[model samples]
Target chain A: MKAEKILEALGEIDEKFIEEAMNYNMKKKFNWKPIIAVAACAAFALAAIPVANHFANNDMVDGGTTAGTVAPVPGDEVDDDVDYVAYEYSVNKGEIIGNHVVELKVSKSRGRYVIKDKLDTQKTVYLNGMEWTAKYENSWSETDYKVIVDRYTGVCNGRNMSFGVNSITGKCEFFMFKTTGDIDKTVKLTRDELYEIAYDNFLSGGYTEDPENYQLSDECSNGSAGYWFKFTRFVDGIETSEHVRIGLRNNGDLYWFVGNRIGEMKDVDVSGFDMDKIYDAIEIKVKKIYGDAYVDFEREGAVLRKRTDGSYVFDYSGHIDVKNSYGKVVQERCFLIVIMD
Target chain B: MTDETILEMLFARSEESISAIDEKYGHKCRKMALGILGNEQDAEECVNDAYLGLWNAIPPERPSSLAAFLYGVLRKLSLKKYRANTAGKRCSYYSDALDEIESTFASAETVESALEGKYLVEAMREFILTLNEENRAVFLRRYWFMESCREIAAALGTSEKNVTVRLTRTREKLRKFLEERGVEI
Candidate 1:
């Protein structure tokens, strides 16, 4: 077996990151963000929320081993969970580019996940005072679960009612006591009762939901578990991309409140988007990226994507359904197109 | 030459594409390799091998940055060459650099599963974003750009010891940071 190359691994942490760092070195433009920041000050110019929040000396202990001199001890075993003691710190403000400083905030339950499997689940819950039935697409993976546990803090309110979101990976889930902690029986509750518990217990943990624009979408369950009720939010009068859901156990305790789905970003007027020209460019660009000229794709309406520097640019996203000559759909993949000015 | 022009030549399979790359990125790639392998001959071999790899990869991969793509290939080739050259006694500038960081994670009881490729990259990305300009540049030059502490110190008009001391402190802090974030040391 080949030895793990630490140097190579560190060098490639961000192929893009290294490029940006190189550019910074070449340009000699000094960044002042780290003076007020904590550790992780040895990176590229892009300022991200610190994964570890608190301020500490971070100096190595005098004992143990020194760098590069200590050899791996054979027959030694260690547990990852026990050793992981990271307290992630999030930064809202970013670099000041031009006159605008953009602070990018996102949902906690957002991270890259290898889709293990999507579990179809459904249930009903009262929104404000009205009962709504909703469906859910839930997935469970050990790696994904570890990722969430490692990053977010959650509260276990008896009978599987808990609220948590690991911001880095963007995993947000909140469980409520839907039915008196029992799956066999349904306990009835009034509007006032549901509203009090939902707002006070679960909603305080960084979840912003609009009671007026709450819309019920679908409901289903894994049969063995309580049903999940999904709801979409429309903040103010404008519709956003965030999704909020509440799950119910058969014995009538609103056992779950999950707010997820990609957030609807900066409201920009993309009405000037030239449908014909953009699609033509996408057709060519997708071919170049994927190496398949016959990729049949569609472009959703364009929106402004916010960069770290608080600047917004026109961007569009769509997916391509690559079908064989037989017209049978063989594969599906999503792609993003950024329209740079 | 601009990356777009070089890319177009490569896409056209023009023989001049290789020369363009040579003219544009050859010295940069060679210096990068020299940092890792610590020898001119091996660094040159790594550079040539990297060019060949780029010739084969660019047709299907339209990288956002051609220099990054080429550097990625060259760095990998250099690491391979360094490994082959250091069988009896593992010694090189690259090894020295790795040794500096190994104090953070190289342990008999280290959890290998906790240190995954994707996670490290993302962690490093987040970590880098937290740095200020001067410290960040010194740290990146030594680690990412594969420059020596002396070189970085010279470039920044500081003592070699200062660069090494700053990096050591910063890395130790990173150790604490990752550990606090549940990264297995």
Candidate 2:
């Protein structure tokens, strides 16, 4: 048989299949409108919703001896239930071009966390907290701001380990919730149990009115820190930057919970936004730093969320491996974050 | 610019559509062509021709996926160019891919004389549709794009050895699939 004939036949496969193969990276960007619609319908009839959790909720906290490092893994059971609407699109090929200012405002940072601390020792940590400052940068601007945890007069029970706020924008940078309970080294919870705890904590903490609306971050795992679960907030089909991360002790006790709940973002057009620029910016930034060394910027996740004040927050989280001239991975699997642009 | 915007430009017969397509998919287009032709000049020419082909096709034919449609055009152009080349100047990468397909159908010569290209395509399509998402992607990436195992592996965040093993298994599966269907080649 002629190889060319078979080659030609291979080319004649359906365009849909061809499209599917081409979009292996954006494989999650399926016809997610249907799944999201189903979730929305489920949200409306909350009272009549079944008490049974979609995932297996057995209290099986007795597995896996070694604590694992939490890394983002795609496609969890929750992925089947609450799908993420990633801003997936191609870019116009080129350099850092136009300037688009995405402002994170203070007024939009109004999310309440019912800080419930069981132990009295937790109060001392909150009072004697040392000041920490970090710089935040997007493509347009960079500013150094102090991390300020708002002292909610009535709820400051010392159980809330840290409620981080950006001094400049006054937006809730992050709010941490620690269990302050006893930690048993032998207690290891399964991913599903941890997820259930995370979901319960997210709602009980008053992060959002609807907990089912959020998509579970692909990267939920049990590690040395304990069983960790992250659920990302979604609005109008866009996976917002607002998310809740919960870490549980091996014994399935809540260790510490950190969450970001951004207010509603207006006019977030995922289809209209050019995703190529974000990817291109990451590539250019890598090249600038590495100076043409063999570098692979494997995108673990890219998110576009809303700042409570309704500004867009575009962030890229990925693993970058920079190889030296000899093709050895000198910088192996280091995490990179391009904070809100 | 979105593919829809580019298509609209093409419908209006604007030359800028060509530039937009070039700017958006030009690098990937060139890379695919180069994979098949193994020559930078030929790949560049093939990509430029593909753009013109896209321009001519879009007015009468509205494709659901512009990127896939463009790749199909570019691939056909690249394959035609590859066939026109001399034996010594052939792209080993593409030849290797084709050789695997040849071997897959080598034993099922019973219907080779009776088969039309479309039947083979239909049979292959049926086989491809049966594969799981990952395997189907690996098969298409290897054969359709004429990508190296290393390239495919890198794109997939896996090892080249794993890709090679997957291709080998997929080829075996394809051979059995076509053999079972009595569609030789």
Q: Could you say which candidate leads in lDDT? A: 2
Docking quality class, candidate 2? incorrect
lDDT of 2 by residue, B1-185 (tens): 45777899999999988887876678678889988988999999999999989988888999998989999999999998988884655556788887777776664455455456778678767888899888888889889998888877655545788888989998888767766776554
| Regions of model 1 farther than 4 Å from truth | A1-5, A25-341, B106-111
lDDT of 1 by residue, A1-341 (tens): 11233454565655666555443432123232433222222221112123222112332211110111111111223222221222222322111111111111223422111111123122332111112233222211121211111111111111122122332232232222121211113223333344445445434423333344655553332221234445567667566656654554322445443333224334555566565675677677656543442456666654555433344444544446553322345333332435455
Which CAPRI level is candidate 1?
Answer: incorrect
True contact recovery of candidate 1: 0.26
Which 10 successive residues of model 1 chain A have the least lDDT summed?
A95-104
Flag regions of model 2 displaced more than 4 Å.
A25-139, A142-341, B107-111
DockQ for all models? 0.11, 0.23
